[model samples]
Target chain A: MFEQAISAMASVVVDPYLLGLIFATTILGVIIGVLPGLGATTGAALLLPFTLTMDPVHAIAVLATIYVSATFAGSITAILINTPGTSAAAATTFDGYPLAQKGEAGRALGIAVISSTVGGIFSVLILCFAAPLLARVAYEFRSPEYFALTVFGLSMLASISAGGAVKNLIGGIFGVWLSTIGAERVTGIERFMFGNYELYEGLHFVPIFIGLFAISELLVQSKTVDKIIKTVSMKAVKLPTLEDYKKIWKTILRSCGIGTFIGVLPAEGATVASMIGYSEARRWSKNKKEFGKGSIEGIAGAEAANNAATGGAMVPTMVLGIPGSGTTAIILVGLMVHGLRPGVYLFTEQVEKVYQIFGSMFVANVMFMLMGLYAAKLFARVSLVPTQILWPIVFALSVIGAYAFQGQLLDVWLALIFGVIGFFARRHGFSVAPIAVGLILGEMVETNLQHSLKMFDGAWWMILTQPLALMFLVFAFLGLCGPVIFSWITKQKD
Target chain B: MKNIYLVPLILSIFSLAVIAIALQLDTSPEMIVGDSMQARSFPIFLMILKLILIGILTFQFYKNNPKPVALEKYHTWGSMFLFLLFYLLTVYTDMFIGIFVVIFLMSILWGERRVWVAFLTATITPGLVFLLFDYVLKIRFPRGMLMNLYYG
Candidate 1:
């Protein structure tokens, strides 16, 4: 097995075309990653169709490269502009932009790049060494376990719902409801089509994701564009001093750990990982007051966690045929399209392919770090481009990307519709993340719940029968309730 | 009366109505061989949950009596809407014409009213997209009638 893995990793041919594709796609991913509204998932989704004709290995390499590099690249905008390029980078802006404002932008960028590289490399290594073991563990998960896991994921709404506990639950429940729009999964029943044939297949994720993230953001930004004073000058970038690095070492370590853990959980994407890492870092900080104001630790924790989350997310994706995040779910589609099934069998059966993927991810991380260091100043200048020119280009790409999804005009129309919906959602302070999370987890929750119920003759006790399921249920519940509990405790103390 | 909350409330209600209609059409079975539950189970569960959430949210809006802050100025909603409308119109039209015109018009909408700049953007953007998507990526786009004009 080790020999096979080694040979597979070693045999990855770095021909000129492959190298060029990797570099070009990695750069493209970085550019997309730097755009606040576009994320790794959107980047991957946009680029996915282009790879359909390429060799499966090459396609996997390109997609993996984009996925890995884009994950790290998002921190650039977050740190530089204080606007998170992807939801995952939200925590980075907590400290990253502040550091940029203080003229230590270079240092913050350097550390973010380095720590991200480290976290990514570390996760890849873990993936390499522990994939078989992890896959074996994943194999043990039954329907009940999966059902519990989905429940646990939904429990995360406590942290996500901004208005109140009830609001969050309502949002999550709404999300699960939305997932049911397509044709029935079990009995092939066509529920809720309203006689529109388009409704028969149910709501496509591409439209919903595009609507919630891109459209909603545009709407919100439209409302607040006046308040969005472009703050920093693009002139004279600064790097972190030695002292800054020394101070943030602990934060980087803690955040990497946090991110990795969050990443490992199925359906919890990098955004949640970064948020948790940032919040935890703040909680554990000796100088918590310095956090949102511009602490290096904040940037370090967030960037490290978000980057590390990519590797963590891949854990379940490559092992259990279950994706840990929305982006990975799309990646799962790509993997399946390439005829690669994600499971423990993949490691034993397609060890070479797995190794090659792992190897490509490592290379992508290194490339991102190099590009981030050498081209920080150039990328930062993107901010100087007026929204007038920039937005049109973005709109054009959005249209092209939407069409490219299935080469269908209908998808473009769907994207536009979603864009409008997204715009309004953003204006109302309703987060797109929960909607996304809901969309991703909706099917998982429903399917699993039904399966678990069947196993126990429709009895709820089956959920608690399996130790793993119970543990996940408890953990999810705690995760959901933790913020509220903490808030109440703090309030009492005060 | 603050009407801002009413918008989302109405939207949510509309969404629920759509969902309810969709659910009614979902007459699929409850189980298949390989997986645990039937096809309709998840969707039905989700629809029911959405109904409850929408109902609660609508109620919350009424109960809370949330006030509307003045919508921020400078957002060119009309321009944005026009841009979207033009984009949809272009989809049915010739690809080159659609791409060129939308780019030009969107540039104007975004406040780049310069004739030269608009002309440059309209032409260059499609050219670049064609080169990238068609030539480099090898993904064929809808050539529409422009295919006969250019290739034939």
Candidate 2:
């Protein structure tokens, strides 16, 4: 296995095109990542169609490069603009923006870049060395385990819902219901199509995601168009001072660990991992007051965890044919397009290819660090671009992006419809994340639930009878309800 | 606020109506894998859920009367109208020419005061897209009249 891994890494010869592609894609990923409301998943989805005709390996490399770099790139905006480019980077904005406000923007960005690279490299190494063993472990998992994993993922609702428990539960339940739309997996029934052929496949995630993030944000941007611009005009990019590094090293390590663990779990993606990491980091910090106010530690913790989560996300995707997050789910589709089934068998069946992919991720992580350091100033300048110009360009890109999907005009219509829906949802205060979560996990949840039901002769208690399944169910319940319970307890005490 | 649930309630009903209409269309037993359940079950379930959620949300809206979050004010009508008009126009026109024209109009509407900058952006944006998506990435876009007229 070690030999195979080495050979796999070695086979990735660094040619000019590969290097150029890596650089270009990473830079593109950074730009997309830095833009508020456009995240790694959407970025990957937008770019996926363009990769349809490319070499599968190169496609994977470019996408992976973009994915990891974009994850880190989100921090740049979070620190400078108080707006997280990706949901995972939201934690960074808590303290990062504050630090920037106090003229420590350079240091915060530097720390973010360095720690993001470290956390990313650490996860990639694990992916490289431990994928086979992990895949073997994952192969042992059954429907019950997946159901449990989903439960655990849903538990994150407790942390994400800030409005109130009832509202959050409503949102979450609505999400689960949304997942049940389209065609029934086991029964092969089309439920909600309203006679439209497009409803046959259920809802396509691209339009939904674009609606949730981009469209919703556009609406919010419309309302806030008059806010004074907050651009960081740093004289020079500041690297983290020695003392700053000393302070954040522990937080970085812990967050990376948290990120990787959350990432490796099926269904839980970068957003959850980052949120959990941020919450935990805040809970454990000596300078808790500095959190959300621009502590470098907060930025480091969130950035490190989010980037590490990418590596963690890939673990299950490479091993179990299950994606932990939306981005990897798209990647799983790409893998299927390449005629590859992701499972333990893949390690043996496509060892070199797998290793090369992992190896390429490592290279991408390193390249991001270098690129981020050099291009920080240039990217920072993007904040100066007026929203008037930015929104139109983004809208144009949306049109082109929608059209690029199967060259269908219907897709453009779909994007517009969803964009409108997203805009309203954002205005009204309903979290768009759950809607996306519903769309992505809907098929998996229904199919697995049905399959498990059949296996247990339609006894819902079978979820409890199976230890692994029961454990996961408990975890999910805990995850979803934990925050409400805690808040209630706190309220009572107060 | 009087009809907080008016939009969603109506939307849910419309969705159910659409689902009902679709059900009248030809569906096969092959479409139904086993038992009484089939591809239609999920959609029906979704419609039902939407009905319930909307009903509950409506009830909650009346009972609690939650205030609408303060929204930022902007000249959204102009932008929205322009976007809608452009989108409709593009459906009938060629994508390239339509896109170019729409972008120019949008930039102007977006208050890009500089004519030279607006023109340059409008022209170069499509060119960049053509080069990137068409030339480099090799994505075949909607050629529309341009392909038929120029290439053919």
Q: Write the per-residue lDDT of candidate 1 for residues A1-494, one digit (tens) a residue.
A: 88887777666545566667778877887887876666787777656666666787788888788778878888888777777777788778878888778877777788788878877887777778767898777778888888777777667654542344445565566666677765666666665555667666667665555555554455454443333535454444345578877887888888878888888876676888888878887888899889888887777777888888888888877787666776776677678768888886787788888998887787788888888888866776654455556566656666676666566666667777767755655455555555656666677777777677778877768679799999988898788667768999999999
- Candidate 1 stretches with Cα past 4 Å from truth are A12-16, A77-84, A93-103, A161-175, A195-200, A215-245, A275-295, A449-464, A481-494, B1-8, B15-44, B54-76, B136-140, B148-152
- Chain B TM-score, candidates in order: 0.70, 0.76
lDDT of 1 at A396: 68
Per-residue CA lDDT of model 2 for A195-227, tens digit only, reads: 677666666655555555555566556554555
Q: Proportion of native contacts in model 1? A: 0.52
TM-score of 2: 0.85
Off by over 4 Å in 2: A13-16, A81-87, A101-103, A129-131, A142-212, A265-279, A286-294, A320-323, A336-345, A456-463, A485-494, B1-36, B46-65, B70-79, B136-139
Question: Native-contact recovery for every candidate?
Answer: 0.52, 0.32
TM-score of each: 0.85, 0.85
User: Where is the poorest 10-residue window by lDDT in model 2 chain A?
Assistant: A161-170
C-alpha-based local distance difference test score of model 2: 0.71
lDDT of 1 at A160: 46
